[model samples]
Target chain A: MKKLTLVLTMLTLSISISFAQEVQIHGFISQGGLYSTEYSYIAENSKDFSLDLQEIGINFQTDVSDKLHLGIQLLSRDVGVYGEGRVTVDWAYGDYYISDALKLAFGRVKNRLGLYTTIQDFDFLRTWAVLPTAIYDLGLRTVNATLDGVQIHGNLDTKLAGNLDYAITYGKLNLGRTSDIAAYAGQLTTYAVEAATTKYNLGVNAVYNTPLDGLRLNGTYLRTEQFAFDPIHQTLDLTQAGMGVLNFDYHIETDIDNIYAGAQYLFNKLEITAEYNMGTRHVKEYITGLNQTVLDMIGKGKPELSDEKYYGGYLGATYRLNQNIGVGGYYQIYMRNDDLDDEDPRKSTSDIALSLAYNIGYNMVIKLEGHFVNGLGPLSVSLNDELTGDLSDLEETWMYGVAKISYNF
Target chain B: MKTKLLPILLLLVFASAFAGEIMVANTVNPEMSAADVEKIFLGKTKKWSDGTNVIITTLKGGAVHEAFLTTFVKKQPMQFDNYWKQLVFTGQGKMPNSFATEEEMLTFISANKGAVGYVSDARAGSLPGNVKAITIK
Candidate 1:
C-alpha cells in the first residue's frame, strides 16, 4: 500500500509537468452500503453494513499534436481485493481522419465489447447498481480492463437519404497472468486463498443503432475465448493396480466461447433495454496421483472429474420524470450448471437481483437494490470443502437492500 | 400545480417579451450535418476538421434550452440524465463545461474558436466578431 501511494504521487508529479500542456482531469468517487434480512442465504443474520469507497479514478488526457491524443487512467478499484491500483493507458494513439466514413486509431483503445463496457467510464448508462455483473465477469476488455491494440471505430452518417447509422470495432483480448486475493468481514485471516492463473484469449464485437422517426433501436453481439494454461486430467487407484486414468486435461487447449445480444428502445419519456448472454466453460480437473486421504474423500467418485456450463441475462427500464430527474428499475438473473454426481449439492442454481435508481443531478445519483435467490442446490458446511453436499431443505430465498451514491468530477 | 404553472407562464411571458436571437457556426472547410451537430453537442465529436479540439458549452439547467434539445436535436433532455448516467456508469465522456446564462454562453463561444453553443434565437444578430450562428432549421 505504501509503495502504491508513493508511485502514484511521483507519477502525478511527472504527468502534471510533461503532459500538463493539455491535460484534462476527470473522475468520480462512489460509496455505498448493503444490508440484508434473513432472506439472504449467505447472510442469514442481519449485520451492520458499512459503505466502502468503490472506485476513485483520475484520467489525464493530452493532445500531443494535431493527429494524436493520449489518455491514462489511474483507478483505485475494490474488486474483492481491498484496493487495487489499476492503471490503464486507456487511449494513447493517433486518429487520422481519412474521410467522414473512415478513421483509424493506433494505440490502446476500448474494443466496444458491449453498448456500455467500452465507456464503462460513466456510472449511469445502465439500470444495475453497477454494470451487469455477468458482462463484467465474462466479457473481455482490451488488455484486461482496456485493450492494447489498434482499431478503426467510428459512426457512418450520410446526408443522401435512407442510409443507416452504425458504430463498429475489432480488437485482441487480454491473455495475461491474473493474481489477486480478497477478504471480507467475519474473517480473521487476510489472505484466504490465492489464484495464480493465466489464459489465452481472442475476441470481436459490434453494435448497431437505428432510429426511425421518434424511436431508436440498438443491438449488439460479442464473442471471446479463454484457454487456461494447464491441461486437465484425472487418475484413479485400485487395490492391485492402484493407478487408473481418464485424461480430460487434453481439452484444456480449447477456449470457452461467450456470446451475447441486446436490444434497447427509447421513446419520448420511456426507455427499455434487454440483454442475453451465453457461454461454454470446460472445467479441467487434473488428478494424476492421489493419496488415501484424497481417495477416501472422493469415495470412488469416478476419478473426481466433471464439467459444467453457465448462462444469464438482464432486463431494465427507465422513465424520465423531467429533464434533470428520472426513475428506473431492473432485474438480472444468472444460472450455473454444475454437472456433477447426484450426491453433489452444488448443482445448477439460479440467482436473481432487482434494482431501482434516480438521477438526482449531472453527477449525483441514488440507487436502491435487492436480491432474490432460490433453488440454490447446495451449501458447504466449511468454506474449503471440495465435496459439496446438499443442505436439508436447502431451497431458500433471501433479500437485501443497497443504497449507492456517486459523483463525477 | 396551479401555482407552479403560474410562475412558469409568467417566466415564459417575460422571456418572450425580451426574446433574442442565437447564432451558431462550424470550422471553415467542412460541412456539419444535423447528426454531426448532435454528436458534437453530445461530446462524441472530439476533433474539428482543422485538427482543433471541439469544446461544447451549454447553459447549466433549465426548460428553454431543454426544449431546444428536444426539438432540434430530437433527443430527450432527459438524455442528459442518460448522459451523466453513461459517464458515471461506463466512464466514457465527461459533462461539458457550463455557463450560467445565455450571455455567458455567447461570451465563451466567442472566445473559443472550436466552441459551439446556443442562446435565444432572437439575439442572433448581435454576436461578436469571432462568433457566428449557424442555422439550426
Candidate 2:
C-alpha cells in the first residue's frame, strides 16, 4: 500500500513538470563548527567540538502563469558520522491562485513556525551566526521540516493591509528509534505487543504574520500525537525472573503548543531584531504489572512525570560598517521547568549563547560565537554507566568559540 | 576656514553636476504604457509583434542605469543590485548589453529589428531617424 501511494505521487509530479512553463533550481551549503559543553544524548555533560555540514536545496518558480506554481528541495547533513542523516523533500508544494488577494497550496511546505523557518532560504540577509535554539528547537517539537497537507495564504495590497496565512496537515512522522539507555531502561517490553508495535503519527499546525512598517510580528500554534512502544512485564529482576508479557493497551498522547512574536527594523546602517517564545508538552499513558515484584518496581521510584512548560527569548543587532565589513551579535536564553517537585537531575535548565559575524564579501561570511549553558536536565543524561538512574556530575557551565566560512552558488 | 570650505564644497557640487538623466526608447510603438515598456525591458514580453527577439542595451552598473531603475522599479539601489545578482547567479536570465554613449545606444537599437534602448531625451534624435520616447513613469 505504501509503495502504491508513493508511485502515484511521483506520477502526478512528473506530469506537472512536463507541462510546466519554467522550472528553476536554487540551493546553498553552510558548514560550521558547533563547540558545546553538551553534545549528544550521552555526552550531555561533557564539552566537545563537532562540525555540522548543512545544505538547503531549493526549487523555485521562474515563470508566472495561470496563477499556479510548484517547488521542492532535498537536503543532507553530517555525511560521515554515525548520526549522519538526510531529510529529502524539505519542501514541495503547489500554489493555487484563488485571486489577487488569496492563494492556497497542497503537499509539503515550510511550517512558518517562526521567523527563521520562513526565511531560512535568505541566509545572507540574516544577522545571526545560527538561529536561536529557543525558537527553532522548541517550535520544531511537533513536526519535521515540512508536513504533507494543505495551506492557505493571502496578502492585502494596502499600506495597513492585513495579511493572513494558515496550514493544517495530517501525516505520519518517523522520529526513528531511541538508543538512549535511560529511555530504553524505562521501556516495559512485552512479548505479546512487542511484535505488534507500529510507528505512526498525526499533527496540525497554524501560523500568523502581520507586518507593521519595517517590522513583522508572528504567532504560531501546533498539536500532535505519536505512537510510542511501552513495555509491561509480569516482574522486574536483574537475572532471575520469568513471566508472561503483554503490550499495554495505551497510546502516548503528545501536545505541542507555542506562541512566537518578533520584529525586524532597518536603520541607516544598522538593523535590529528580537522575539519571544513560550510552550509546554504533555504525555499521558497507563501501565500495569501482574506480580508483586513487578508492581513494586513499576509503582515505586517512578519519576514524578507531568506536563513540562518552558519560556525562551533572544535579542540581536547588526551594523554595516561598510558594504564589505559588517558586525553583529545576539543573546539567546532558554529555560525549562519539568514541574517535578523532587530534585531530579532533570530539573529546570538554562542556555545562553552570543555571536558576532562579518561579511567578507557578497558570497563569504566569517563568524565567532560562544555559548554558556547552566542547569542541566535529564535530556543531558549520560548512558555510559551500567546502572544509570540520574547523573549528578554534569558540568554547569561550558564555554567555547568557533569560526565559520560560507559561500553561496 | 570658511573661504577654504566654500571652495571645496563648490568643487564637489560642480564635479557632480554632470550626473546626466535617463530616458526609455520607443522603437516599435510610441504609445506603450510604462508597465508594458518595463515588461519589454525585463525580458518578460520576449518579442515584438513582428516576431523578433527584444534586445535591451544599457550601461552595466552605472549611475544613469541606476537612476532609471530607481525611478521606474521602486527598488532601493542595493536591492536592485541583489535582484540582478540572483538572476544571473541562478542562470535564469542575462545581464543587459552595455554601451558608452547615446549614439552607441541609438546605433544598436536602429540596427536590430526588435532592439530597444534608452538615452537622455535631449539626445533622442541625434542618430539617423526620428526616434520615439517611451513613457517610463
Candidate 3:
C-alpha cells in the first residue's frame, strides 16, 4: 500500500509540473456505513454497523491536439474484502475525434454496458448512496466496470428522430479468485483455488433521445467468455501399485450473455427511471488424465451444469423538494431462475429502498437510505464467501440501512 | 391585500434582477439561431457553420449564469455541471471554460475566436466592439 501511494504521488507531481498548461484534474471521495438487522448486505458480519464501504478516485485529462486527448483515473475502494482499499488504475485511454459525429478511443475504457456502469464510481452524480444493486451489482465491478481495448462511440443527429448516441466496445475482462463470480464458482469445487481469467468481452450500447423533451430510451448487450482454475490435493490409495498421494488441477469455463433496456424521463424537479436486465451463465468443468475411479466419483451423480438465468429490474422515482433536498424510492426484484421451477424457492428476491439526499453545497452531498429485502436469490453470495450445499440454509428476508457523505471537485 | 401584493412585488424584483443576454465574439458568424446557441452550449454542436471549432465559456455562478442556463440550456446549474462532467470523464467531450465574473468571460471571448458566452443586461451595456450581444431568437 505504501508503494502504491508513492507511485500515485509521484505521478501526480510529474503531471502537475510537466503538463500544468492545460490539464484538468477532477476527483471524488465517499465514505459510508451499512447496518443490517438479520443479514449482511455488503460485509460478511455486519449485523451491526460496518464502515467498510468507501471510494476515492482522481482523474486527469489533457488535450494533445485539437482532436486528440488523453485521460487517466486512479481509484481505491473498500467494499467488504473485495476492494480492500487497494489502489488500482481504473481507466487510462486516448480519444481521437474524427468528427463531431464519430470518435475512437483505445486503452482501458469504462464499460459501456448499462446506463450507470460508466458513472457508478461518481457518487456525486447520482442521488442514491448505492445504485440499484439488482442491475449494478457492486460485487461484479471487476468484471463489468472496464475493458482493456478499443471503443467507437459517437452521436448521430437526425431531423425526424432527434439524436441517437451509441458505443461499441471489444476487449477482454480481468477476473480473479476474489471476484464475486470466481468466488461463487470456487465454492462449488473441492480444492484451493487460483485467480480466474476471461477470454474476451464484447458489448454495444445505444441511447435514443426522442423528440419528446425530458425522455430518453436505451439498450445494451454484452457477452463474455470466462475460465477459472482450481488446484486439488488428495491421497490416492493405489495399494496394488504402491502409489501414495497425488495432486491435480481442474478448471471450469463459463459463457455469459447480458442484456439490458432502460428509460429515463426528467421533467421539472421530478426524475423517474426504470431498467431491466437479464443474464445467462453456463459453466462446464474439464478434468483430463485423471484415474477412472476418481473421474467417476467426480462426475457420476452431479447434475449436468444448467444455464443459470438471472432476471432483475428496478423502477425508481426521485423528486426534488428544493435545490438542496431530494427524496426517492425504488422497488426492485430479481429472479435467478426466471423459469420459475417450483422446487427452488430461493430463486427469487425482492426489495424496496427509500432515500433522502441533502446537498450541502455544489460539491458535497449526504444521503440516508433504508432497504427491506425478501429472499436471498443472487445476493446470497454476500452472506458468506462459501455457498452451503442447500439454498434452504440461507436467511429468506432481511433489512439494511446506509448513510453516506460524498464530496467532489 | 398588502400581503398578497408584497409577494408579487418581490417576484417582479427577482425577475428584473436576473435579466441577462447571450453574447458572442465578433469572430462568430452572427447567423446563429436560438436552437444553434443551445446546441453549442450543450456540447452537441461542436463547430460553427463555417466549420471552425466553437469555444464555449460561462460564468461559474451568479444570477446571470443561472438565468442563462434556465433560459437557453434549460437545465439547472448542478444539472449542467453534472452533464459536462459526465461527458468529460467518459471521454466523450471536454468541459467548457468557466469564469468567475462577466469581465473575465468577456475578456476570454473577445480574445479567442469562435467564442460564445453570456452576461447580465447591465453588464452588456458597456461591452466592447469586439463582443456583441446576440438575440436569443
What is the TM-score of chain A, computed separately for every candidate? 0.68, 0.72, 0.88
Clashing pairs in 3: none
Q: Residue by residue across B7-102, what tens digits does model 1's lDDT show?
A: 110001112222342425434422345555566666556766665566667777666577656654556765764564444323334456678887
Error of 3 at A204 (Å): 0.8
Per-residue accuracy of model 3 over A243-294 as CA lDDT, tens digit each: 4454554556778999999999878677899999999988776555466576
DockQ of each: 0.21, 0.06, 0.30
Question: Could you tell me which 10 consecutive residues in candidate 3 chain A have the lowest summed lDDT?
Answer: A178-187
Candidate achieving the largest DockQ: 3
Model 1: per-residue lDDT, tens digit, A225-245?
Answer: 443333334344444555444
Candidate 1 TM-score over all chains jointly = 0.71
- Predictions ranked by lDDT, top down? 3, 1, 2
| DockQ of candidate 3 against the true complex | 0.30
Question: How does the DockQ of candidate 2 come out?
Answer: 0.06
Report i-RMS for every model: 4.3, 7.4, 1.8
Candidate 2 clash total? 3
Give DockQ: model 1. Answer: 0.21
